[model samples]
Target: MSWFKQGLCFLPVFLVIWSSSTFIVTYLIALFRHDVDIIFPYISDTGANPPESCIFGLMTFISACAGTATIYARYKYVEKLSEDPKVVNPRLNKTAFLFGMLSCLGMCIVATFQETTVTVIHDIGALLFFVTGVLYIILQSVLSHRAYPFGSSMFVCRVRSGVAILAFLAFFPTVICAFFVTQTTLHRDKGDTDYPYHIASAVCEWIVAFSFICFFLTYIDDFKIFTLRVRVECKE
Candidate 1:
């Protein structure tokens, strides 16, 4: 394989690094500015202010674009892998692609609208991202398992399954804890009875976010074997 073909693997690697960096940089900036408590802060809280918010918006937008590219590539990869074509249903892949893009749209919304400033829109965006993102992965995991010993390995299927399972498990706590806590508990009084829920929500949110990241990391190896190209044809 050419070096160009080899470089394809970097796409997923970039997504992982860039996404994690966005969270870390925003978290550090929030910490330095004392925008949030030193203990586990909501990922949005880190980027709810001026400087970090700016970086957060830009970085996450790029992350969404990268995520879109990753899903499309995987969609094509599976399409090519199908021997009977029915062995892997095109509808399933298309559905996964749709959900994946919707998740990216959610991420874009989350990026463009600041949580503190536009709570409702931001929360809606977040809902789109998390719910659809998990659905996307779960669908992809099923596809991977179905493709096993052909387009994918048993190991890859297992890993994707594990990550999808973790994300699914963590998602409920993240949402449930957030549901129980009020703004007063999250931002104002740590002494409130709901404070523990606030912390648990933040912790679970981080796990879900990183689980999403880890899920994509599995793609790096698979992406290594193929090169993506665009073809244009004319009928004369």
Candidate 2:
């Protein structure tokens, strides 16, 4: 295979690095500026200020684009395996694609709307991203299990399943704790009454985000073997 063709495998790798770097960079910026406290802050909190917010928005937008492409490529990969015309898996694969796109769209919304300024909309976007993102992974795991012989390895399937389970386990605590805490500003001081709840939610948020990133890393090997192509034909 051509180098460029094999490069598709790097999409997930790029996403994992890019998105994680976004969070780390923004957190460091916020920390250095003393805009946020030393304790854990929501991922959005790290990017709620001026310069960091701008960087957060731009990097997150890039992440969304990369994520969209990765999801679509995985969808096409499954469609290729469902070569049997009678197989009903294509419909399920399409559903997974829709969920993945919606998750990416949510990331776009989060990137565009700063949590401190438009908290409701930002929270909505976060909710959409987390909820739909989890659903997308669960569906893909199912498809991976079904496509065992034709596509993914048993090891990859099991790994994806494990990640999906971890993401699901983290999802509820993130949401529940977030509700218990009240958002007054971008940063939360340890002295705040809701500090415990805030920390819990923040930690869980990080877990879910990293889980999503880790799940994508499994795609590298799968993408290495397949070459996606476009065919053109003239009909008389």
Candidate 3:
């Protein structure tokens, strides 16, 4: 099949796997909260629950699948270009492959290390993974422009760049909130300062929510560009 057709086939499959894995992990988190209520009646009153293990498991699985897809897509694109010799730039293809591989490895490490037992290590790992993942996506966006400047350039590029900047801006507040929350949790042996911790935690929550929204918007833009290419090709 043509490059356009191959892209079309991969696009929906990637979205389905990506979206479903995220949804399942989120769903499991909610389920875990309900289960916590049964274990300790006072826990609901305190409104404190441990992070769900299921989310981490789901994240690992999703990252693996995504990593495989990234490697495969890069290889396939390179192979296609090699066959035709005039189809696409080999250097751009190699860049995509390299970044994709890095993203996969980063996610795997982040997911493996994100545990409540090692809160500091987990947070640091998460921060590293988050930065790397964002960078990888940004690199892909840049490379897409290099490959097909006019055809790939779309509104999504602006949206993603803006969102990524916003995420960076919010990072400080999130880190500060995390610090206060950690301190409060550590003082648990002394007394309960849940209220202050709750406020700080809420801020962190908002930052995370914003980050996810930004990521989704970026992916949506990617899908739009992929679809446009397929449609344009079909018309010709």
Candidate 4:
């Protein structure tokens, strides 16, 4: 019933929406570049099963809905914050918001071009996305620690810290893998498949997968416990 509770309810919805948008945009880029066939078995053989355009378009729609939900949640959360008496760091929050927005923009631009043309701009955008992701992760780590009361919940603290560290470790491998994979795939037309490159690619793939698992497990556990607590508290 309180504004804080309302805002909390919206946080997950917002994250989901934001994540979906990124996924949709990425899907579109994959479709446009005709790389869909290489990555997807359903469409790899004939390039017909998923229907590049259709799949991307559907993903775009889904992403749009998610973006809308995120906007709604953010607006509500901001409104709730306005009622607080604490001095808000407008500068930091503004910087974070801008960084996040630019990151999304860069991601969308990169996705749009990943299919149509091979340009340095796309690469730059990809790099920007990587940098932005790192910044966001760091910001989140700091914010999470600042928000939670120290010593009030040791279990939660350890869990959060462990997740942060794992996520940080995962980022490096994933980013490196993404860069190498993009470069290698781009140069595939030139027929340059050295043994080390292949090995690097394989290692990168494994690292990326491991990093994703760490990230997913971290959030999944957090949310699962949070939801369980909510249910228990409600029943009581």
Candidate 5:
């Protein structure tokens, strides 16, 4: 592959790793803060916190770039795999990739509208990120059943796909339960947060984030055959 193609191939990969890492790091730092309760506060709350907010918001923007790159890579990878035309649907891959892009866009929006600063936009972004992202997961799960032009491990694909599907399937009920329970606490008690509901939502959000990361990790195996390497000799 040319240098440009090589860059394209790895852009999403690197961005994903960085974004995921930054998210974890920011959360860890925010967890120690006295104002926020690690167990119940949403991930977005971390982004709302003063100092850590910068890091979380930056990571979210990076995630959007990663998503754009992923969309490009997905199209190219699927196109390459579909050259034979006899097996596989390029269209399906394209659709999944589009969904992934929208998911990323949602993250960007959430970052732009931090929870404390603007709850409505942030909530909209959260819903968009989760719902469309899960749809992408489901589409990719279906695609895994088909054969790739380049070699693919059915076992790995199946397992990853299954996990994505199951986690996504669980996200809905988990969020709904959390919402109702949390709302009751907010309205009935007025001051006390429903720890159970808050904790549940936070957990579900983490699971969904994990699933998103895992789906992208599968790309590492797929990109294994494609490499960008440079050799340098010192003084010899």
Candidate 6:
């Protein structure tokens, strides 16, 4: 029982829950501190706020750690399940796992440098994080489709694939638009924060975020099997 409990702490689910909770709390605090417009401001703005900077800084570090653990756990979990008879035909792609790990590293880089303090470094991190992140999602979606071809999970895998593509579609174009809009605004008036296109970009970014998050839900079905293994081992 103790071993089961201990092992549960290392699951991807645990890490994701921890990271998500930290982010939610940090965001709420930042929202309260700057209660102007929550939906329109980019996610980075919450972390960049003066009052919540320190807390969100720590939150990013925690997220980096959790991201690392989550990717590793997810790889191991899926790899193991691929060998099961229930799987249609398993193909374990180490390349996908490697790319996923790189995404986590990108996340760490983003967390280490604040956007407000170091714009260039932060932009690079964000670039790596999102580009590689969406790549990982697409690759994993392919891997999942291969892993779960005809089971109940197969449908979820397809859904994940769709969501991943949606995230990519929503992210890249909006990113270009946002960059162009911000640049145009800066050139026009340094003091103006009234760029309507910026808010549009923020909204699209949130859409991308939601889609990416849903893409990860494909693994939720595996949690039961993993947790069951823990309980059985503990029982034995």
Winner on TM-score between 2 and 5 is 2
**What's the ranking of the predictions by TM-score, best on top?**
1, 2, 5, 6, 3, 4
lDDT score for residue 187 of model 6:
21
Query: For model 1, what is the alpha-carbon lDDT of residue 169?
Result: 92
| Ranking according to lDDT, highest score first | 2, 1, 5, 6, 3, 4
lDDT of 6 by residue, 68-90 (tens): 66666666666666666466234
In angstroms, the error of model 1 at 228 is 1.8
Q: For residues 1-236, what per-residue lDDT tens digits would candidate 3 score against the true structure?
A: 35325433455346445645553444455455653222112111122223545465455557556655645554464345345445456666666566556555655554555344554565565565555555555555554444443333566556556665666665565556546544323113224454455454445544543454345434433333332222344554
Error of 5 at 211 (Å): 1.2
Model 6 weakest 10-residue run by lDDT: 182-191
Reference-based lDDT, each prediction: 0.89, 0.89, 0.47, 0.42, 0.71, 0.64
For all predicted structures, in order, the TM-scores are 0.94, 0.92, 0.55, 0.51, 0.81, 0.76
lDDT of 3 at 203: 50
Q: Which residue runs of candidate 3 sit more than 4 Å off their true CA positions? A: 1-51, 71-100, 144-151, 183-236
lDDT of 3: 0.47
lDDT-better candidate, 2 vs 5: 2
Stretches of candidate 1 above 4 Å error? 1-7, 184-189, 234-236
Off by over 4 Å in 6: 1-10, 81-92, 149-152, 183-194, 227-236
TM-score of 6: 0.76
lDDT of 4 by residue, 1-236 (tens): 34324323444444554454434444455567665423321111111223553444344344334433343333233333434424233344445455555555655555454333445676676556545644544454444344444211445445545654664665565445444443333223324434334445444433432332233233322332221122334554
* lDDT tens digits, residue span 1-236, model 5: 45335434466467668878866777777777653555545677666777888888887888788777765666566667777666668788788888888888898998788787887898899888888889987877777667543545887678768778767776886578566553521112325556566666667877777777777767655654554345898995
Better of 1 and 6 by TM-score: 1
Q: C-alpha displacement of 82 in model 1, angstroms?
A: 2.7
Model 5 lDDT, residue 80, Cα: 70
lDDT, candidate 6, equals: 0.64
| Worst ten in a row by lDDT for model 1 | 182-191
